[model samples]
Target chain A: MIILEYLTVIFLLIGGFFLLVGSIGLFRLPDFYMRLHAPTKASTLGIGSILVASIIFYSFKGDGVSIKEFLITLFMFLTAPITAHMLSKAALHVRQPPRPDTLNIDQLENIRDRK
Target chain B: MLENTVLAVSAAIGVSLLLNLWRFMKGPHMLDRILALDTMYINAIALIVLLGIYMGSPLYYEGALLIAMLGFVSTSAVCKFILRGDIIE
Candidate 1:
């Protein structure tokens, strides 16, 4: 039981740290394409960690291993990348500006123009 | 001990929420704003789940699920609008 408690605490803290990192990345990143990478990766891991902790905590609470949290985690994992991809595609479609040093600018434009 | 940990985690999520809000408000482009909004809802889900755990209630899970569904749909619709300039066409 003590070990479980320790694990829960560790997971919660790690999850919070990643969530903070993701939000900071969202705020500080310079361009749309660059910014698209952070939350999709970091925040997904963050929330997944927290959900794992929740699952552990509830399972030990005599609730017979609540599966809802697992479902949420799985749902998040599946959807986060899809949303990020769609958002980036929309940004690219509209020619949202990229940072000046970003590579593949002309390549992307060429591809778009050919379509 | 668990309560304190939950509180700290909730506070961290709150800070993230504020940062997301700042980005949403100050975004220089429409896509940036949309991305920020998407991240904000995800942060909100974390907050809601933490709240549910802290409160020891299963009911909040349903609310979190609903938010997750609606948030994704709205984000996709907005992105589609940006891409095609029409959502339903």
Candidate 2:
């Protein structure tokens, strides 16, 4: 019984580690596109792990195996990238200027042809 | 052991949220700010789940679900507005 609790805690600790890594990546990444990779990947994994741990703990406690936790994980996985894609597309459509060194071939050629 | 782990995980999540808050405040671009907000929602949902586990109750799960669903809707709406300068038209 105590061992089971210890295992659950270990899972939670791992999840927290992933969350920390995700935030660090979000802070340190260079551009919007690069930064997009961080929170979606790291944070989603972190949250999913913790949710899985919760499910396990509850199941062990005879709580009848809640499936809502899995639903949340599925929802987050499905939505996070789609949201990022929508935001990136919107950024592009609005002509939010790319990073100064951005080597956008079409944009560069268009500018060159214009002048 | 379990109590210590819970405390540690909560502290770590709290620190991560603080880091996200810094991004939200300091972001140079609109999308960066939006991304920060989006990430904050994810963190909040995780915290809610953690809270449920800590308190040994299932009630917080409903709150987490609402946060997840509403967070997605609000984010998509903002992204749409950013693109079109109008949300529904």
User: In DockQ, how does model 1 score against the reference complex?
Assistant: 0.82
What shift in Å separates residue B77 of candidate 1 from its native position after superposition?
Answer: 0.6
- The ten-residue window of minimal lDDT in model 2 chain B covers B1-10
- Least lDDT summed over 10 consecutive residues: which range in candidate 1 chain A? A106-115
A6-113: candidate 2 lDDT, tens digit per residue: 778878988999988888888888877778889989998998888888887787777687777898889988998889888777767656665577677357435434
lDDT (10s digit) by residue, model 2, range B1-89: 66667778888889889989999999878888888888889889888888888888888988988999999999999999987789989
Question: Tens digit of lDDT per residue, candidate 1, span A1-115?
Answer: 8788888889989999999999999999888888899999999999899888888877777778788888888888989988998998887788887888877777878756736
Under CAPRI classification, how is model 2 graded?
high
Output the lDDT of residue A113, model 1.
71
RMSD of 2: 3.3
Q: How high is the lDDT of residue B22 in model 2?
A: 91
Span of ten consecutive residues with least summed lDDT in model 2 chain A: A106-115
Best by lDDT: 1
